[model samples]
Target: MIRFALILTSLLGLGITCQAADKQDLSLLTRTAEQFARRQLADSDAKITARKLDPNLSLPACDSLEAYLPPNGRLSGRSTVGVRCARDGWSINVTLDIQLFSQAVVASRAIRAGEVIQATDVQLQRVEIGQLPSPPLGSIDQALGKTPVVGIGQGIPLRADMLRAPAVIQPGQSVRILVNGDGFQVSGEGKALGQAALGQSVSIRTNNGQVVTGVVTGVGQVTVTP
Candidate 1:
């Protein structure tokens, strides 16, 4: 009877040891998943957060852990990190909540549609990028000289979709048409057939009664390519 009791005690001790080792393995796996997530996410300034695994969740011990992102996984917002132990045929996924803060352009005052953006009309501010309805303009250089497609209220975040290059040439305006070939550069006067922004294509009616198409290269210049 004494020998049997001793054997039972030893078995119980062994079970406890196994349980502790399993917990350590799981902890290592979780840490690995977190590291993988940090590397895959785009925001260098992002703050990462994740919930602790349930204490009662039971998983078999794994020889190794491989962390990966699932298909169609995004780095922003709510995301999941998958950790697998192929040797043990067991896997778990960790869900993470991420937030990124970055500089964004905001309207200093109400802006009307078709109005050109001015340097003083916008300001840079640090905002939670993850919560933006759309990606906001990150620099003042991007906002300057762009015309708004719609009116924006004061303090509103400025998005790239809302603005465009302001027209530099209007219909019936006189423009210089520059024609260039392998070794020849020539210039002529023409009438713009339509409004065009810098770098946009414009149709021109030359003084010689010839209609030509060219790209608007400057405020009053069009470059014709053959």
Candidate 2:
């Protein structure tokens, strides 16, 4: 009977050791998630944070933990991160809250319609990328010399669709038209039939009474390939 008791005690001790090894600490999983997020999203401007796991939530400690995103998954906005153990066939999906922040150009003051944007007309502000109604303008260079399509309020974020290149050549004005051929280039005076911005298309009536469409290359200048 003594030999039987010794065998039973040895079996019980082994079972306890296996159970302890199989149980994983929650802290390990959270730390792994945080590290994975920062590495994968290193190129992005947004900050990444891993939420705490529930203390009551029980999970087997995985021998190997693999973190991955679902197919067609994005790092922005609401996303899910999957942590799985291939050997144990157990996995956990952690819901992540992603916030994207970026710097954008905003109007420095009230800007009137058709007013040309200047260096002092705009400033940069840090804002959430997803909240903008349109694509945010990132630099003063993009807004400089561009005219607003409509009046804009002070402190409002500037968008590309909100502004445009000011009309440099107006209708009823005289323009120099350049015609380029295989071997030569010729210049002629023409009357513009429509207003045009830089690099925009304009219709011009040459002095010879020929109406031709050309690309506006500069102020009061249009170019045509003949």
Candidate achieving the largest TM-score: 1
- Predict model 1's lDDT versus the native: 0.86
What is residue 112's positional error in candidate 2, in angstroms? 3.8
Candidate 2 lDDT over 1-226, as tens digits, reads 9999999999999999998777877777766666677688777677766677787877888778988887887677677788888879787777667777778999999999999888998999987775456779898899999999999999888898898898889999999999999999999999999989998899999999999999999999999886
Question: Once model 1 is optimally superposed onto the true structure by TM-score, how far is the C-alpha of residue 3 displaced, in angstroms?
Answer: 12
Enumerate residue pairs that collide in model 1.
none
Cα lDDT tens digits for candidate 1, 139-218? 99999999899999998889988988988899999999999999999999999999989888999999999999999899
Going through the candidates in the order shown, the clash numbers are 0, 0
Please list all clashing residue pairs in model 2, or write none if there are none.
Answer: none
* lDDT accuracy of residue 172 in candidate 2: 91
| RMSD in order of candidates | 3.1, 4.3
Worst lDDT run of 10 residues, candidate 2, spans: 126-135
CA lDDT of each prediction against the hidden true structure: 0.86, 0.85
